[model samples]
Target: MTSLDIAFLATGAITVAAALLAVTTRHLVHSALWLVLALGGLAGCYLVLGAELVALVQVLVYVGAVVVLVIFAMMLTRAPIGPSPDHSTSRLHRLLAAVLGAGVTALLLAVLLPLGGEVVARTPVSTTGIAEDIFGTWVWPFEALSLLLLIALIGAFAVSRLTRPAGEVRR
Candidate 1:
């Protein structure tokens, strides 16, 4: 195939491998780090596909904002950095989760495969158009999402502050 196809395949493989590692890892912080790698690999795929704006957004939103927020929340809640026996699932649970994930993936493929042949003739969307659509039409929803994230950060901080030692005096 072409160079772009090869590049995309490489990036996709990296993304999939990183995602699998992220899910399977026992260490909490390591999982988040793997998630960052997966997201960055996804951005690389977007870049290979010539979606620079989408790649930028993927990096900024998912890698920079979401993963950082997740790490912060984890730290704030005092989540275990290393492996915890309490978080381990039984073999049956793991098997069932894998089966469910595969079933959903198959279902999605079955539904979407039929639409693959219906190619619509349309002009390529420009970065400016997308920016306008996001900043102009979808600004309110974006702002609301930001507010929700801010509230979550505040909640995490509040929860963390409430778990002080018995001997510690309140301010």
Candidate 2:
């Protein structure tokens, strides 16, 4: 195998591992941190695949913006840092979830196994073309999404503040 292939594999492995940890961890902040690692690893995988723009977007949009927003929301809401017993599931629920996950994995493998032998040629994409497309055609949607996220952040802050007792006042 080539070095690029090895790098892709390594990054993919790291991404999967981090994603698993992000989901399975009981601590809220730790899960968000693991999500950052997962998203960063995904960006690395995109880089190894030679999609520099995609890699940058992955890093900027996911790892930089989304994960930061998650952490910020957590802090704004005063989320528990450590494990909470209230979030724990019973053994039966855990077992069912595992079984469902395995079944979905098997289904995906079954669907993708037929395409394993086929190699599709990739066309080179220019960074400028992508940038123009994003900024020109999709600019409004992108700006709208950003505005939506900002609104959501503000809403979270408002809700968190409203949760205080009647006698409590902001300093």
Candidate 3:
């Protein structure tokens, strides 16, 4: 096999292992760290596929911003830095998750392998054209995403404020 094939296989394995660890780990911090590894693996996959912008955004948005925010929230809440109290998943939930994941994988393969008809091939469009298309045709979704981020920020502030200790409450 080619080097690209080998790299893809390795990254895929790392992603899966990290995802499993993220789900199964008893400690929340460890789970978040595992998620970082998973996101890193995804970024590597994007790089392999020649999507430098996507890879950079994946690393910056997921690893740098989102995960850091999650860790900071954990610290702010004074959540248990050790293993979580509830690590056991019910059999039904486990089965449901497995079925959902398998179904999604099968659907993706079915749609992309042959039925999609060469959609994965790199297009010749320039980055400026792509940006223009997004800004022109997909402006609503972009604005909605910004609004969603604003709402999330507000919610985080509200949660932090509500969870403050009694004696530490600020006016």
Report how far residue 52 has shifted in candidate 2, in Å.
0.8
Residue-level lDDT tens digits of model 2 in 86-110 = 7789999989999999999999999
| Ranking of all predicted structures according to lDDT, beginning with the best and ending with the worst | 1, 2, 3
- What lDDT is reached at residue 124 by model 1? 87
Q: Model 1 — which ten-residue stretch has the worst lDDT? A: 162-171
RMSD (Å) per prediction: 3.4, 3.1, 4.6
**Comparing 2 and 3 on lDDT, the stronger one:** 2
Stronger candidate by TM-score (1 vs 3): 1
Overall lDDT per candidate, in order of appearance: 0.91, 0.89, 0.80
Which candidate leads in TM-score? 2
TM-score of each: 0.88, 0.89, 0.70
Q: Taking the tens digit of each residue's C-alpha lDDT, what string does model 3 give over 68-121?
A: 777877765556767754655888988999899899999999887896565567
Candidate 3 collision pairs? none
* Model 1 whole-model lDDT (C-alpha atoms): 0.91
Backbone clashes, each candidate: 0, 0, 0
